[model samples]
Target chain A: MGLVGNVCVVGLGLIGGSVLRAAAGAGHSVWGTTASAADASAAAADGFDVGTDAAAALRRAAERDALVVLAVPLPSVGDVLRLVTEHAPGCRLTDVVSVKEPVAEAVRRFAPSARYVGGHPMAGTSASGWAAGSAGLFADAAWVVAAEDGGDPSVLREVTALALDCGAHVVPATAAEHDAAVARISHLPHVLAAVLAAVGADGGPLALALAAGSFGDGTRVAGSRVELVRAMCEGNRSALLDAVDDALGRLGAARGSLASTGSLGKTLEAGHAGRLALTEQRAAARTPLRIDLTAPDAMAALRALGSRGGRITALDGAVALAETT
Target chain B: MGLVGNVCVVGLGLIGGSVLRAAAGAGHSVWGTTASAADASAAAADGFDVGTDAAAALRRAAERDALVVLAVPLPSVGDVLRLVTEHAPGCRLTDVVSVKEPVAEAVRRFAPSARYVGGHPMAGTSASGWAAGSAGLFADAAWVVAAEDGGDPSVLREVTALALDCGAHVVPATAAEHDAAVARISHLPHVLAAVLAAVGADGGPLALALAAGSFGDGTRVAGSRVELVRAMCEGNRSALLDAVDDALGRLGAARGSLASTGSLGKTLEAGHAGRLALTEQRAAARTPLRIDLTAPDAMAALRALGSRGGRITALDGAVALAETT
Candidate 1:
């Protein structure tokens, strides 16, 4: 296959719909399936190849030897993986779900023979469903492709290619690392936003009225669909619990200092430094590198690159062109 | 006195500079002073009256019976209040500090004879200094005015007019109530943002690379000037401690639920509900009501309106025009 190939996306929600559109837009033959009648009809109305039957789509993917992208929520992962096992077992599989380890486990349980790679594009809006998706949604976004040791390098390359086709740079890490990182950056924020929102609400209308930019920005994600938020957070329960504990410890220390010395200077200063680190890292110049996917230690190289904040911007044949800040 | 009066603003930083510009724009004779020569020079170069000598400005205010608006940070409040006592003692006094109770207490300690009311505009940018200030900074923002019982109605009206002139709706609350409300909304968010930022940073550069809109928004205020953030949070120490305790309780509950039942549905649902309340309240139609500031229970009436999320939009003679959602 060239840099692109046939793409089959299961579950045409925001991420999946966008993946389908972006893949087709990148010159790959793409099609998708959705359980939602409205989403299926909407996708079809948009002149894209879409359907409501997962079994039929998986069968086509099986015959075509296409890369099947699972894009369902955590709760629905098992059901779709069952269909994949029934119709497209042993095919190249990847997913766009938020949590990685859980989905990988599900794939292991339901479709053990499949060549599976896990992925999560770190991009989304508060909106969901087919109509809310866009081909440009993943542009310049970080798409994590799990770099499991002993996994097929060809499948990994294919996953990286798909991510690049969707206009996202690929970050390669193990499923456990990806889950832990997202637990800190994503899931913990949801929980914090929820707690902050509830506390502000408990202060009654006056507190809400006095809320300004900080309050609005901090609690913005709490407005996300409750069920969706709960699913992802709960799916990564272990990692998220660790993150929550770390945050609580810091908060407790801050409280202790405040109650003792009337100073939150230490916590505020550390946070300031952390924010500065983020700003500087983002603004730092990138150094280019390449990893030969066919190399003996390619997976380890890719994992190390991701750990150091490097991203694979393009796949030149089997040579993964990467950059690190 | 007219609705607008002569205004003397101490500390020509973002808030004070903006207040000076706005008051002048509103046809009040406005002048300001700052300890920083840079801010004073910038304000002076803008062709409005400004000086480095706060004592001179306070003396002028004393001569003109001007309203002395103390706009210094919490740390510098005592020094400025001392100046007010020495030069503008017994003059109509108010402040634009972040915390109210501390400033109110400082007033009682340093300038007991001055007719004092505390104010805090719920508006600011991450940037600071005279150059960053704009006359429209507080437009449509909530400006909390401490409505202490036995606080002279005239001083309350003066502060309300200043807030209205600066294009902010006045939220009448007691100093304690204002501090408590802001602890929940402003100070608590700052703490949470700091904690969130630190946690993301702890996940290392990979996590920062994966940080998306949610993480960015949740920790935006963590990028603010460290000393300024520390000052405000530390100034509201007592109330912030309470708010922090409440947050810790909620977070602990979330962690427990996640560990025990592997579910965060209740927390997410409550957050969703809280966010919805904010949206609905902001969008709710307002019913206009007038509070006669000279009435026997006028202060009580104003506090009641504020507690119910009402605001005084304009001052017309002794009748304060207000609206409630």
Candidate 2:
């Protein structure tokens, strides 16, 4: 792939549509397709090059050696990968699916010949569809790019460049690690939100009326599309199960303490410390670092930086400019 | 008590400071005392009647036959009640403490002669101290007023009028019922947030870095002051324990489905339905009603309306103007 290749996005929903807009805004030749005729029409009406044919889009991407992004939801990943296999057998590929390991698995199973690099831009709104997307959706967001052992550096560079161009910093991790981390930070929260919402609602209208900021903020995401939430959560089932177990264990301990001792001191203190850590991390002074992409241990360095909460701010030729807090 | 009686607020923290501001804004005779010298000076500098002596404040409240508002935290309630007993025995009383049952119990044990009515305004920020408060804090908020059997109608009317004058709609409930409802809506969310925050932090810095809107919103209240959170959660131990058990049950079911069937469909769907219920309740059309405070069954009517989520929007002479959605 060239330093800045043409971009082809499959699915013109929120993430995909935003990718098309952002890539084009970054000066890449960009186009996308969607199964939803409404999304296609919306994108087309907005003067974007969006179509309703996945095969045709993949064929054109193959001809142009474009970086094909699977921006579809988890349920649609396999079918799109099949199309990629038939139309562009070994195209430079990446994705913006929420769960990383599952998408990576799908790509390996259906389009093994593709030079794939798994990615997930950690950004979205509760809204969906083409009309709900914008060029700035990913600005200043963390975009996770998988750093598998023995992975091709060239394809990784291609993915990193795309993410950086779309106005996001890169966070490198293995697909498994990405899945595990997100299960705690993303998927488990979704499940908990659902539970909290249901429980709050069960308190009848009085409880709902008494609900204030905490309830409103805690259950805000429960208002997201249910099927979409279920798809991402279930897609990362193993990792999410572990997170759920950890949460339940903590909750059980809290309940035991409250019942027997009338104190939630330990639980509240731990949570307070955790929140303080987050605040400190966000407010910490960042130190700049650069990794030469052509170096023998470039992938290792990238993964190490990401594991320590570092971000690749830009791709400077074969070097990745990064910062660590 | 006069129709617009004097309001004496002890413990000038966020809620107390706001009460002073709002009551004064509503043209009530207001005065407050705080243990924190900094808060006392700050409130005094703001041209409000603030002091540091609780006994002196209570003595003046006794002289004026004021409606005393104990806005102290749960752990301090007993100490403040002892002072109230010595200085203002049988004076009109209420409180803005988060937990209702504990405060009521304290009142019964320490100052049983005080004409007591329990209250809790369902409004707050994650901030504490006088500087963090404002007159508009309770605007359009639900201020719960306990409607116990054979409770004094005059005392309830004074509290109701104060809440309405402060720009809050009054929600009448039995103290025990209020505690149970808040456990589900207010206290459980705090525990869950703490658990969620701690779990996310356990994923290491990478997880925190990737924490987006969902994680942030879900754990927002975990950032609240740990001591304050502990006091309220521990204060309502029984009801919060039940709520915690309910949450754990739902979480266990979610985990089971994920482990065996790789689906969170039921949990997500229930959450969606719960969120929909909240939306519908907020959007439901309202019907106006009024209860004669002098009537024999006024307390029953008020409690019944409150149990159904009805709110007293205004006090018209001897009547409570309310609405049910």
Candidate 3:
């Protein structure tokens, strides 16, 4: 394992913390910042190198030529970018935000030199907080990387490398495409669950009791952190609104079919087709892996090789090799 | 365990076979019939006294002064009623059909002599067929009994006792009420799932693959037995249609709030209220339990108390207790 030299992970929450853990696990000198000293100390206790603040974290991360990963909420991503501009002026940076458009805009406005690539790890649960952090949470998950303005090839490669080190499949797309895809697949389903739960809630107690498996399963996500979903809906209003409308229209059409005694076979066929199509597209290719080898562990491993003055391979990227004798 | 007096369960599929297992387990002389000799033989081997010929099974059931349970589908319930009239003329009868109105009509049109009470056991899974049968399937489930005209009180009590022995809570209501209740709670959810699945299917392959936990859960029942759900839609068309319309209108309201950037908090508040309302309703008083005491186990227990020469203690119309010298 080679320590990642000066890796900066913002927002010390579950996703960011997991990234910190994975980077540390892979021998990366992880630098992390949080909204509070408590979270910073917590990350430090968990083996992350806690910086004085977000700006300090960025500066120290930059001095070490670290990769900065913005892992804040969609709404708070802009503020973090502002801090990045005031601090890490020349560092190659990327984000782990779920929605991409706003972060891309913020990066364009504030941190123009920070090679900003958008990243979304399609992983989560209904629970939140640092206690929910796990190093292997993102394993085998699809890590979507969105490149804006033909963004720095090195930054894209570096983030893709980071994702691979954490055992994720990397998929590249544009910011607009990512937002639209998530709106249709993720945002819409949450709205539908909430709506369905509301409907079943009014069905009377006996009906609810006899709900069996269907209602419970369907309403599971409705019980998710409402504030987080609300933030997503608000931050990505237009996209989510359109998604909701599209979902309702589809539901309306199906209701009409059921009402008219029309063929239900057609309805089921459409669902089957949709599910198969999504599967085929994702099975396109395997993800890539790279690492930084100019770190402590790789240098040590290099020294042990009884070799001199050569580059060592990082699991995520091809960082310049350390001289070994 | 003494065998229950002759019990006829029409239709040896999941629900019917399940009833057969529970009754037979309780020592009832349970007899069941299926569409094919294969099903009957399978049921027979599984401990039910099943016959390939429905007519003969019905006649034998009737000759034993048994309670016959109509366990066929909605579309076939009417034809089975006619068969009941010709073969099981003297048997007291009930049904285990999901919907109630059509069968209520069928019961009125045929099998006039038998004290026919409509029964709906609100228990099942996505699975069907005799192999899916389980003795404890009805445990803690609500068994809805619809009171019909000319249905004897004593027969209703007997059926309630059976529901208890099978580990079900009894809920009494009229056929129309039962139809309306199920339409809203059960049938509406199926339509919603179908609509959801249809949207994903039509959204192209990539869009569908991105459907995660919520979508899968919400649309799980969409892939249910197509014919059965379609028949439910058609047989209880008016109620189901009304429920679908009502659910759509509610969903439209939710969408409108999001579209207009109106109070989402208000819409969510309404949903919260509805859910609480359902929770309160289920905590109310429970319906009484009734079933055939001549069920084998009950009969054995009864005979063990000493056939005819016993000191009678209490007789609560449908049930009685006695002490043997």
Candidate 4:
């Protein structure tokens, strides 16, 4: 219940570096760790207190009241949790891994004494490494917090405040819910884009030559780091499998509707409605993010957050934050 | 064949305005047509000779030894072709519609004047309108020329040269090939994106809010002009239906592969190979295009063609061209 005064981030990659920057900018003493001397030295040079040794970094972080965030990949999260529990056993810990059910289960099994919560900072670029990190990267992004059955409310509150400090909106969900939601939103889309890129490959030389902004934009993430996507797919296989099946079923329905002799307008309308809803939700969430502003003027502009009495917290040198009082 | 020193573009929308800019930048005198007086005035102000009436534009175009480029929507292409043949029957004509088979069939049925050739610029953005048009838009894009059975080579050459002048690589495919290729590459992707958006919508607000770069990038084009997509789906129903079925079958295979204790690495490898092939093809084809250097480092960079055998044809302000010898 102590004030969330210090934040510790493990991994020091894009997501970790971003959290470090956002937390540091929010007046917290931020601590970071990496697997190698090279990454630690690189992060330290960027004004973060990162150390070469993970155990040493954890010991330094445990000196103060800190909220430890495991920002590693899904498969590695469990091992990191075990290490943190053995090294800095008293500090509260959470993870920024994308998939949660397995990670939560691992935390429950390995780190019984520590207050461990599962989190996914639903923000990142395809770019990785400390060099690719940005200060305001997590601004206006979603942070999904999955609470286990016996999870500590004080630890969850500290995690919530940390996410909010990084200009993220906090959403509470179960570990299974979090996994299913991300499977529908993130992992399935990556697989679909991967297959889409495959189709363009068949056109031989001309297809790539013929690709314009649409193709490039559509397949932008198809070139994502293969190892990361692989880990994610393997960790959340069942949920992702269900999502793919659901997606195929929807495609089948559209194909059937369009092929029917009935009014094609209904099928098109359904698609239009679905697109509008998705875009509306994205805009609602993205109004606070600092993404590129390259869209044409004809698109919708950001509107004010109405009637919500939540206190708005600001980070220095970050994007806009207007709180409703 | 007479000299095609000038070209008239009817309907100053995305496709038409882009043609005028490309044609003009490629050393052809360009005229434009607009139904509204305001658009005509804007076109004239923008250095194009504008005609308020379609027939008048075609006649004026013929008087100046120009080819008429029809750049209207799919539903209206037939009417414009009929009007062009009735008014300026001697002028060679071409059209830039996305779905070629239906338009080609319509041209055959409505405008049997062998001067009308079916053309499609395989380049575009999610953007539309005159302001969105750029001189370099078509540079290094693909131009598909579908030759009618026993059609005039002179007309085909004019369209091909126009395509080349726009700095596009010319790909000659039958209307059937064009339709099938686009169905697999273009229409199918749109349908899949729409389906993903639908799935995201069904997951409720929290899931939609968690949509990151992958979801946005994958479904970016789904937010494009709904009417345009609808028209494309309706016009190319048969090909699109087959493509949807094919995509569903692919997804089914992936689901099976993942469900079984088989190699997830192979599934990942298939995606990797698909993306790598497309990337390699783009790199090879991009050797002859005047791509901008300001794009993100992750995006396809436009390097000077001097290293290759290709040479810059033009570089004035925003318009740049690299042509292969």
Candidate 3 structure quality by residue, lDDT tens digits, A1-325: 2334557898878788788887777676777888867767776776667643788888787787889988888767778888888888778887777788888888888888787777888777766655577789787676776644456656655776777777775555567766766777777666666666677665554356455566666666676667776666556667766666766776677667766665455655565455445445445552222224334343233223211111122233345222221
How many residue pairs clash (N, CA or C atoms closer than 3 angstroms) in each of the candidate models, in the order given? 0, 0, 39, 0
TM-score of 2: 0.96
| Candidate order, TM-score descending | 1, 2, 3, 4
Off by over 4 Å in 2: A1-3
Please provide TM-scores, in order, for all candidate models, with all chains considered together.
Answer: 0.97, 0.96, 0.82, 0.78
Predicted candidate 3 versus true structure: per-residue lDDT over B258-282, tens digit per residue: 7777335555555545545554544
True lDDT of residue A215, candidate 3: 65
Q: How far off is residue A183 in model 4, in Å?
A: 1.7
* Most accurate candidate by lDDT: 1
Once fitted onto the true fold, the runs of candidate 3 whose alpha carbons sit more than 4 angstroms away are A1-3, A147-149, A275-325, B1-3, B147-151, B267-325
TM-score of 4: 0.78
Instruction: Give lDDT tens digits, candidate 2, residues B1-325.
Output: 2355799999989999999999998889999999999999999999999899999999999999999999988888899999999999989999999888888888999999999999999988878899999999999999999999878898999999888888899999999889889998899999999999999999998999999989999998999988878877888888888889899999999999889998899999999888887888888898999899889988899889988878999888888999998
lDDT of 4 at B240: 74
Q: By DockQ, who's the top model here?
A: 1
Two-chain DockQ for model 4? 0.30
For candidate 1, what is the DockQ?
Answer: 0.86
Interface RMSD of each: 0.7, 0.7, 10.0, 4.6
Query: What value of lDDT does candidate 2 attain over all alpha carbons?
Result: 0.90
Clashing pairs in 4: none
Tell me which of candidates 1 and 4 scores higher on TM-score. 1
